[model samples]
Target: MSRSATFDRQMLETAFSEIDAVHRSLPEATLSTLAAEVVTRVANNLRFAVQPDMVPCLDEIDMLCNALLSDDPHAATAFIENVQTKGSSYETLCLLYLTVAARRLGEWWDNDDVSFYRVTVAAGRIYAILRILRMERPIGVPDMQRAAAFASVPGENHTLGITIASDLARERGWDIDLFVGLTHDALVETLEQRQPALIGLSASGRRSMPALTRLIVALRISNPNARILVCGQIAAANLALVGLTGADAAAHDFQGAIGHMERLLDLPTGRLI
Candidate 1:
């Protein structure tokens, strides 16, 4: 089937259901065979969505699979190089797959001490599945006592990092209030009214540093007890510099941000509820 023709939501759900059914059956040999089949099916589907012109670049896909599934450092580097040569779509798909595969790997590792190779293989198969599936943003439950909020400084264009961090906090039982593209004054007013325990700021560009600093200072003056966390590409690249800004903590990623928040609030490491 043509990629577009095959990508109907119902069809995708059915395919996923079949994959899940096979997984539930759980005979070792059958599971392995099903995993390989899932990869083949998704790869075939991707050949259409990605265009026949890109079919010859299956080597790049294989390299990405090997990197995530086999822990082959060389393959990982080659995959990244290939994506740079190919286009951003390749890299986007790679990231989507990596996210899914990482989740699966976590589950498998939690269940048993599988060899790293086995973990990689499972990750590769899950990555293939993720490439062909649509992911939905999970709805967050509200928590009144430990609410969290997101804001971006003026001129800051990226919000994905902040969105993910808020989602993580929400998943851990924090009442999350996400405010993308808010100006400094608006963010402070919202924080003052909500009285949330934490305010998260994200900035992806260097030009945003001054505005972010101003916001942090404003927040501190308005709410001395509220903790502030800063994160994003810019923050990660200049951790030491941001640390000097009087923010309570700087997180490199969503996981790190959650961990830092847990420590600050005296919550258990992985359990905020």
Candidate 2:
């Protein structure tokens, strides 16, 4: 059954208002980042506050994602029809469908069963699906007082960790600014301008450590009190190395990062809810 429209309507309106404010103030270069943060915030509010019924079971998600791996358009069509027939909540279903399902697709690439081209195509499909759902459903909005900047180290091309961390941070009501493939100087300048409460840097390779160290040093100069977190394959796989990067903590995954942030900020658990 559809949720009562009243709460979702209010939440979405509030979210859009905040997004409008962000658009009015930030540089045009940052608009895309702001847009992504707004989307994450709205989806998160829908997931936690709205509590839509008819959430897809894990098995159902696995099946749908597997279907998406195939070339047949009929599979996607059937999956959509199934979701519609079950009267699943669009916001909840699409949020999980996009994030968890995309993760599954990534694993397939890891296993060498899917090509990057195929993964990119599947991701686009999910994005398109969510775009359409965004038009039709009411999204929830939560208060965002704190901010975080997430980025890969200069020259690092890895984005999965950044995407996962961004979603997790936004879910916890932190405004997220994503920096992609930026030079260290450019990133530091952006950080200085945003002055977020936290800065998260991800690197898939160890070679970027030198530049990452410089970035961290620059961050310390610009925002002395902001917590720094190092994540992604290198940091998560090598816990001891995080200290060398000057990060307060290292996280292998989303929940770990959230826990680290909570401890650093001295906020109680479940603060976002």
Candidate 3:
């Protein structure tokens, strides 16, 4: 059965008002990034807040991902529909299957297991599915005081980690803007325009530290209020590394990221409900 909306319309309107204020102030170089992030945070959580969904197996995820990369435009959509018809919930198809498939696609790109173009095409399908899923969900509130953006170091060849981390953050109720495949200047420029409250950066190895450090500095200079979290292989480094990068915290895994993110976004009243 279809459920009634579980949101306060007034609250959403108030949030949009704040977003509009930001939009009006900033030159709109990458308008879609900010808009999509807001929508995703609202759409992904509202239904999940009401009811949970099932998860798909690795094989199933691979099948759907393969379909997504097929030449037929309808293959991916058909696969999603078939899964739903088989009694998998819409929530399952989205958060479980489609989301995981994104990670898989990113994995291939990172390891050079597949061509970047192929991975990009597959990733686009996953995004399309997510957007379509949004249409079925009721308009909802973000329930956070500020939004976040996740990005890989400008030239980092390994980006799957940030993609996974961002999805995990969104799963845990963050409004997240993702910056991938951007040049150093472009990433910094787009970030300045978005002005996110928090920024998550991923670096696979020590080789990326210089670029990573530079990025944190640029972000700090440009977005003074934003908290930065350093993750991926570099997070395993000692306390000295954190100070060197000037990141507020470093986390090697999901739980640590969650804990640090919470502390960063904390209010006197505690984390927003």
Question: RMSD per prediction, one decimal?
Answer: 19.6, 16.6, 16.3
> Which is the leading candidate under lDDT?
3
Q: Report the C-alpha lDDT of model 2 over 1-273, residue by residue, as the tens digit.
A: 354212233333333343234335544434333223222322332334434444556787778776665565456546765666655555445555555565566567668787654554454344434433444454332123456678888888778778877877787787788998787667877887777777788877567655665566456445545778887777655635543434678876777777877666666677476
* Candidate 3 backbone overlaps, count: 0
In model 2, the Cα lDDT at residue 28 comes to: 42
Evaluate residue 29 in candidate 3 and report its C-alpha lDDT on the 0 to 100 scale: 30
Q: Report the candidate with higher lDDT, 1 versus 3.
A: 3
Query: TM-score of model 3 relative to the true fold?
Result: 0.45
lDDT of each: 0.53, 0.58, 0.60
What is the C-alpha lDDT profile of model 1 across 231-253, one tens digit per residue? 77766676453333457788767
lDDT of 2 at 79: 75
Could you tell me every candidate's TM-score relative to the true structure?
Answer: 0.44, 0.45, 0.45
After the best TM-score superposition of candidate 1, give how far the Cα of residue 232 lies from its true spot, in angstroms: 0.9
Residues 1-273 of candidate 3 have per-residue lDDT tens digits of 333212233443333343334334433333333323322322232234324335567888788878867766456656766776666655555545655676666566568787644554454344444433543455333345546788899788888878887776676567788888898779987988887777888887777765775576456445545778887888886534454445778988877877777777772322345
Superior by TM-score: candidate 1 or candidate 3 = 3
Clash count for each candidate, listed in order shown:
1, 0, 0
Candidate 2 regions with alpha-carbon error over 4 angstroms: 1-146
